[model samples]
Target: MSDNSSKLHQRAVYLRNLLIAHVTGRSVNEADYHKLRHYFMGHKDTSRIIPSVLEKHPDLSDLWQMMKYNYASHEDRKAFIDSEFSPFLAKLSPDSSQPSQALLSQNQFIDEPTLLKHWLKANEMLEMNPPVASEQMKVLLEKLCHQILRELKVVPDPRQHDLTPLVSLTERSLLLSPGKQHYLVVKALVAGCSEAMSAIDNLTAEGISVITDQAAIPKIDKPTSLVLINLYGSLASMLLSGWRVRQMLVEGNSQR
Candidate 1:
């Protein structure tokens, strides 16, 4: 099978085991997963590359198809074998001899262990002290959003999920006690603005209509109050809010 296919297969196995655990109220025995491995290797028609390993296995074909298609590159395939699949295989055969010295050193950093460790340490610090103010939350939220946008641009495949940990982290930092309520508010605000912007774009394409609302009345009578109530002034203020959101998304891109 192709590299992408292999990765997909491993992901399928992980998901299957997860579902089984959820349904049965028990985790799969990592050591006794011969059935799954056998199932993956049994069928034909797929597993083109590693067919010799399980050519005659009747069940391997279906298992192989689930994972073989998503591999977009050789690196992805190698990553799957080294990071996800090999660990499970290790669990299944614990008595196997040690890996070669080079492989052993490389395995130690699989799953980008350096990044994971840094994330864990930062998490521990946050847990201990806690974010106490909105300002702190704002800085963190911007950083998180920046990271999300960066990843979105780099990872072209639809199968790769973004790091949602940033969302929760920013949410937590922003509102300590009333986090849940604020989270809903933030979601609604973003959704509403996005919808409104789309509507504005559509409307502008047709033609701009200047409505003669009371707020649009001339300021000659009461210049100061009229300035505050003028339709154009109000529209400009509203436009600024939308501009800010655009700036936020844009600023994040430049920073990276």
Candidate 2:
């Protein structure tokens, strides 16, 4: 077998054993391990089997414990295994093999000029009439909430799901070295969004026309608005930083 094939075969066997050990609470004997290894190494459809094995054994505590036993630091073990397994797991699933290009595109930062244009349009509508402008702003905020959830990989269900926890998770996942300001801003944005969604639900329940009835328009508190603006600014900075990093990598590769 080719070197790559051999490596894949070994990994597959290793993962299979780990799953078995997890489910049964007993390690596979060396003889059986070798037997399974050889069988899978010679099998034509090993790639197809790996995902099935993983899916059947969704609880990964055994494998995690094994990694912890081998590595001293919690962070070290997590980083190492995630880096190793993510690629292998992606290979087993057709949908995950390629990155979500559409999602990535949608999450890219809107430029200052584009943002200014939107602001001008919103202002014009407000100037013409409050009701029309209130409706437009409501739609805009709802869209923003959807966009943020999508970027954070959360499937939004305003009526069914309590989004506060998911927002907390998103904040934890995205902010690597958040400061005091970051904490306060993220907290405000999450609370504000939640409040706005709740108000929407209440208005709808009361049969209030959110578009026509000015009373139905959700009032965004000053702190929430300020925090949301800061959040957008931070997102823009992150996008710019990522762009610069990618450019540097490309330049380095070309030079090499």
Candidate 3:
């Protein structure tokens, strides 16, 4: 399996085990709790699972409230799980399985720098022998654009036709003078920011229309902002790499 797939599977298993322990009155270690928090806060789809789990085990209502409000102490969480969840725990068979050791040991953290690092590696590979066809370059640019958008959590509007503008801008930046190339790259990055901001705005409006908790607004906005910043950083790195490659080619041609 691919490394990403494997890591995702491991995380899934770990989360499943942690949930089982929580509902079954088993003592959850600090590592498992931390992993749970990481998954809860980091992944949108995974965060939805908490509500589903709560629905199934309403006895965990207090625990869920504490967790949601960010007021649950370690001792309080442990005590509540052991005492309040007893009726639900009694129905479960004894769990013999442990959390995945591989997952525990693996450092699967992803941030802007990590994304940029991978982008640079791929960019270097392309630069080693520039693709022969302009069409091939366009295809690569489209892939990079989509990857950045996906990472930024920017869902494209169905009304919009394609990413041709962004891709063309990126491609144009590759052949420009160094100073001009930087400006073009910045423009391309700004286009990405515009799309990302639009997505964030739509989501914020939707969220606010439904959930009106003023305190929860910052919790939502902070993460969204961080995600946008990270996306911009990665997109900048990708565009700058293209410019850097162009510079190398220009210098090589001049020398020849």
lDDT of 1 by residue, 1-256 (tens): 3543333333333433332232222333332234334544543522332323233323433334533576544234333434443444332221224221001222232123432333333233232112111112222222333333343343223333222333333223322232342444434333333343344335335431111211111111223222212322222223233333444555666798
**Top candidate when judged by TM-score against the true structure:** 2
- RMSD per prediction, one decimal? 23.7, 19.6, 17.8
* CA shift of 126, model 2, Å: 2.8
Write one digit per residue (lDDT tens) for candidate 3, span 58-99: 344444554545523333333333333232222221221311
Which pairs of residues clash in candidate 3, taking residues 3 or more apart in a chain or in different chains?
none
lDDT of 2 by residue, 111-190 (tens): 44544444444444332232323333332333343444455466544333223333333444334333443444444433
Distance (Å) between predicted and true CA of 146, model 3? 21
| Ranking, TM-score, top scorer first | 2, 3, 1
CA lDDT, candidate 3, residue 96? 14
The lDDT per prediction is 0.31, 0.38, 0.38
Deviation in angstroms for 60 in model 1?
Answer: 19
Q: Which wins on lDDT, candidate 1 or candidate 2? A: 2
In TM-score terms, candidate 1 sits at 0.22
